[model samples]
Target: MSRRVRLALLTPALLGLGGLFAWAIAGLPEFGDYRGPYGYVLNQIVVPLRHSTNVVMGTTFDVRGLDTMGEEFILYAAVVGVTLLLRDESGAGRVERRTRRARSDTVRLLGVLMIGVGLLVGLWLVAFGYITPGGGFPGGVVLAGAIVVLYLVGSHRDYGPFRNEHALDPFEGLGAGGYVITGLAALALGLQFLTNLFGYGKAGTLLSAGSIGILNAASGIAVTVAMLLLFAEFLETYVVPLEPEDVGS
Candidate 1:
């Protein structure tokens, strides 16, 4: 069909869906109402069941773990898609040339400092997620930002402990796969998928909230690796002429 005809047919369907979505949202409980059914359930059940004071953490990594797993995979797939789409296929060899402009020593030093601070903070957030506020997603973003800072400081090949880009590929895979494995273990034991199969330590403690800490750590690792790889792909990108003479034989 022609473009105009396709648009005409799609417009009404799109509008109908949007209207339904708006209607559904309008029917939801009032904003900031702690007394709402969902909030009440989390307050009453999730904390006791998960044996963690952090109800949000319990909800995210335990009660609704399957949903979170799907979301993580969505992000993983999106990054992979972007990387594949932006890949350079030219067979011409790479050439590096020094430019006249250079970053100031102060700027480079600042970047180095930020890398240290970011990594520490990121790990802290991930480790304490079950007991405290933040979790894997935010912690992973912080760690990725640290790697980016290292890249900015002209450390193109390595970032502190992570000396090679190839090693990060597996880290991302492990993070995404670890979550599924944890869930499957629960299923194998006759419990629901993603259930907290391990012991729930004392409430408000680091060891509390069985499986949540592991999930958080896994997610953090995966996210950090994926983001770093994405950054490396963009940073190392180059273009070459399509002429036969310029192309490799």
Candidate 2:
């Protein structure tokens, strides 16, 4: 059969399959209760995190830390795949680089100011994850994006002192490694895997919530930097010309 015919035939079958699956799932309980044996333990042990700013870390690191480790490996595999697929061709011919028109000094100054403010806000969110409505993922991503914006609008030559590739990669690796090691250490200390053997401090403080905050920070850094690096690689590949000549003469 022709490819068009195959797609046409498959489309309805796929739609029907999806409809049936959705129908089946629609019959499930809306939400599981916390009165069951497992829920009883989990609620006593874990529900506190639902109110946490670092909810991902609270659930993943303190409650399901081992699973988080596996998830990190999955992310590692994905990054590796991207790196392999998007390897830079150093030997590619030089492209012309048109000098980007300089912006007004006021515009440049405002961009720098925003970058600083954004970075500060992002760090505040990350640092206060244990006590507020913000968390590591949001904070780190905002910080990374703020820095990238600074790169785009404020400066071309230095890109606001960020290494972009070197520092972020190591930081992400360390974050992933720290999460895994923390879990393993907990296990070795005779606790269940990923158990929060450490004390959970008072609920509304910076130092409370045990390891969840740290895990949130780590995962946030990893995710943010990975995204930034991916964007940077894309810019280097399709947008930013390597050599000055590549731009129209």
Candidate 3:
């Protein structure tokens, strides 16, 4: 389509999106407003009822999980859209991509050190998300970053394994679908969708919050996959691989 036609279609869509956002934002309580009983109820009940200290996680994954599931679908859909847009359309050869090697041993060493540290922290975040301050989304980002840093430090050979579209895309789709599946699992037991169906486990532990923990994990995986794909695209599009002789230069 011509640019003019594209813009004509896009303009109304942007306006409609803006209007919807405005309508949603308009309903939120103003600053300092504690006008609803829900917040009070969650604070009072989440710990005792859900066996989780982080009331936020309980609210996000159980009390109002459907909203979070919708958000996950939005992100999953975006990744799918990007993958489609970036795919070779004409049955063409692979796009030539370049990897940049770090110019100094110190930088490379630091990157290597950080990889281990980051991996540990990311795993911790995902594992304890339901019990603590972190959750799947943030933890997933950290995990993706740790992996992407392999390429950032010029380990193209190592990064190549992660670059497989066949694996990453499906995993992300599964991660996205995982949340819905977890929600639907409740149906098998005659409970409502997204209910905290299993035992709440011990509070303040890795096993707490029943399906809240599971949902957090699902969101984490989805987020990690989405971020990895996006970072791969950015690298492929913009970074050119340096010559072997340029490795330490």
Best-performing candidate as measured by TM-score: 3
Displacement of residue 38 (Cα, Å) in model 3 is 2.2
TM-score to native of every candidate shown: 0.77, 0.73, 0.80
- Model 3, residue 145: what's the lDDT? 92
- Report the candidate with higher lDDT, 1 versus 3: 3
Residue-wise C-alpha lDDT for candidate 1, range 1-249, written one tens digit per residue: 999999999999999999999999898877875455887878799778888677887888988888889988988997788778876678345443222212598988887899899999998888887778888988898989987777567533344345345777788889999999999999999988888878998888888888988888888888888787777666556432354542332
The alpha-carbon deviation from the true structure for residue 25 of candidate 3, after best TM-score superposition, in angstroms, is 14
* Reference-based lDDT, residue 97, model 2: 30
Give the worst 10-residue stretch by lDDT in candidate 2: 93-102
lDDT of 3 by residue, 1-249 (tens): 999999999999999999999999899988898788889989999999998788888888888899999988888788778777776667454545545567799988999998989988998888888788888888999999998888888666668867776788778878888898998889878988887888988899877888898889889999998888877665554555567875654
The candidate, 1 or 2, that scores higher on lDDT is 1
Q: Residue-pair clashes per candidate, as listed?
A: 0, 8, 3
Question: Which residue pairs clash in candidate 3?
Answer: 98-240, 98-241, 99-241
Worst 10 residues of 3 by lDDT: 91-100
Candidate with the greatest lDDT versus the true structure: 3
Q: Is candidate 2 or candidate 3 better by TM-score?
A: 3
lDDT of 2 by residue, 92-118 (tens): 633423335235888777877888999
Looking at model 1, the pairs that clash are none
